[model samples]
Target: MKKFTLSFLLIIVGFINAQAQDFQGMAVYESKTSTSDLKSRFEGNKDITPEMRKMIEDRMKGMFEKTFILNFDKITSTYKEEEKLDAPGQQQSQFGGGVKMMASMMGGGGTFYKNIKDKNYVVDKEFMGKEFLVKDSLPKLNWKMESETRQIGGYNCFKATAVRPVSKSDLRNIKFKNDKKDAAKTESKEKTTSIMEELEMPENITITAWYTPEIPVSQGPENYWGLPGLILEANDGKTTILCSKIVLNPKDKAVIKAPTNGKVISQKEYDETVVKKMEEIRKMNSGRNGNGMPMRMP
Candidate 1:
């Protein structure tokens, strides 16, 4: 009887261990981007009144402040924006469509899935009313673990840093160049004004991440992962994503799966398509007024 009881206890312990190994969790993160640079661009511009500048800033705030949920298990995870109702009267603004387009370009609303075990990712991106499934290898970040430590959501987290290349097409890199001298010269010569231009972006920007070993999962918000533990916070200069709450092994488990519906394409192909489409639009809009009337050129 003693031998039988010992064997039964061993089996029970083994079953519990197996269940523990299949750990799953859901993390809620809040992401925000700095608008200081955008505000500065509006300064000293006489054409934009104070109220107009405030309106623009408010719209930018709405676009950049968002909440995302990350559902993860051992090797795969899905990160997506948590939908929220727009403010009263805010949805009808003329800038709403443009802002949404810009946000989509910056990876704002999408179902992003990462499979660490397969070293690949699939992103469902919607741009200009077109859906695309971007499949590609996972971005590899050479993270240098730092000795620094901090607590996030009651979990001890360690710091890791890496440098990532900046995307030239990112709207954040655009700057309004109010070159009065150049504008005067252009108007005099070409009968047009140039008030905005894209700023040259650096080759790379540094990224800082905080991960907690307590979770023991290689998952994070957006496209960040491959850390020694679960990433709870990450910052890339302009934007910061931080975990607000985490549910470990919740009763209602989330389905962590890759999105399948969309026009299949690689990441490189998708970017090239966006660039080409933008170029076509720019060409179509050149020398045209806001009402779509062609401007008289000297």
Candidate 2:
């Protein structure tokens, strides 16, 4: 066979470069969560007045609304929250200890670094002023492709669904009160307390995601990935993350680097640390405050 001409080879090389450029970009995502359950939980406390409840609700709403940036290049990506303070109400809520834990549980309080090539990830988390670098493999999602499709921000997206097991404590609502029938049938305090214990088995939750193959990077905001394309919208029962804008091959390229400085530990170890710290706080504060007023551990 005759050798290929230089002009033909150049054209093929240019096409390959164009494809590589398509995968290099930065995406901005807006994450929104419904604070109705949180509001209800706060309102249940008799000490809080209606006006105080409303103010807390408003503050929770601000915390729930967040913006994230996903910077990617081929097989590696770094996703982090774009830190911003809009109002004094939100600023005050942001610094609260419980709010930080809640945000971490909701997948909004850390920087996630993932490499699709190696199927590994690192999460940088701060708990009560202590920083932790949690290293673990990526979460494996069993996704089922659906025939449904939609357009988000001008990108044609296909629907995919998956089921994830979530622990009861992970949920914003932890049912403490018993129904009327149960309360009437069992008058023993021990029996009622046992019934209210945290569940051992995880609750199965359905997740729906919309992704577009137009952008071939298998990345999404906050520990969600393993799709055919860039995920445009994802809802995991509790919170929703939607991509608002995408800039491909920007004038200033995004730096896709992982967080390096923190106390290194595995995912399980970090969880244990949090639980141990909480237990210590509870022990320190026991029988100290009265009047049924709310008290937070320092």
Candidate 3:
């Protein structure tokens, strides 16, 4: 009887350990983007005044600085922005609206869900007042791990790097090219120069990520994943996302599920739809203003 009781106790302990190992984790990340380069694009252009430039920079700063939460388990994860209330008396300005429109074109706001075991993902995106459930295969990032290590949030992290293709419409890649000759032809050269005539977008960008093996999970903030361990920090040339806090197996666990509210579509289909919408908007806004000058699409 003693031997049987001891065996039963051992099995119970083993089961408890297994259950503990299958726990979920939540990570909070603070994301910010550098606006220096973006501001430089308008430098020396007669169109944008110092005051207007300051306002544009301020709007970009607010748009890019955000907090996000990543909830993950062994094989699946969900990443989304943490909602925050605006200050009293705060209203959306014209610049804010323009930035929001650009964000919509780039599929900026979304709840991204990734399943490593199935090698797929689903994202909830809102564009032009319509929502889309974008389902697609996970992008395979070829990471090159380096020997460099650092500490982040009490976890030792190793560095890894990868290169990824950039979207043509990505706001980060927007660059303004001013033409002096074109501005000279207009009566209001300052206004004409201020109107962005050419925008350049890069084709690719390099990503640097730091992962902590202590967590022992393949997860990261945003669309980044496939690391051998949990990513604590990641940065591209323009933006950086760093883990601020982490909670393991909290009392209230987040439900990691794919969003099903929007119209189902593949990633390609969603991109095509956005592009078509943009073309329509451009066409509608084309032609001269009442003053017989070319109208700029806001």
The alpha-carbon lDDT assigned to residue 115 of candidate 1 equals: 93
Winner by lDDT between candidate 3 and candidate 1: 1
Q: Per-model C-alpha lDDT, please? A: 0.80, 0.73, 0.77
TM agreement with the true structure for every prediction: 0.84, 0.79, 0.81
Clashes of 1: 0
C-alpha lDDT of candidate 1 relative to the true structure: 0.80
- What tens digits encode model 1's per-residue C-alpha lDDT throughout 255-277? 88899988998877887776676
Considering every candidate listed, which one attains the maximal TM-score?
Answer: 1
Model 1 TM-score (2 dp) = 0.84
After superposition, which runs of candidate 2 have C-alpha atoms over 4 Å from their true positions? 4-22, 43-46, 89-95, 167-202, 279-287, 290-298
Residue pairs clashing, model 1: none
lDDT of 3 at 74: 87
| Candidate 3 lDDT (Cα, 0 to 1) | 0.77
lDDT of 1 at 210: 99
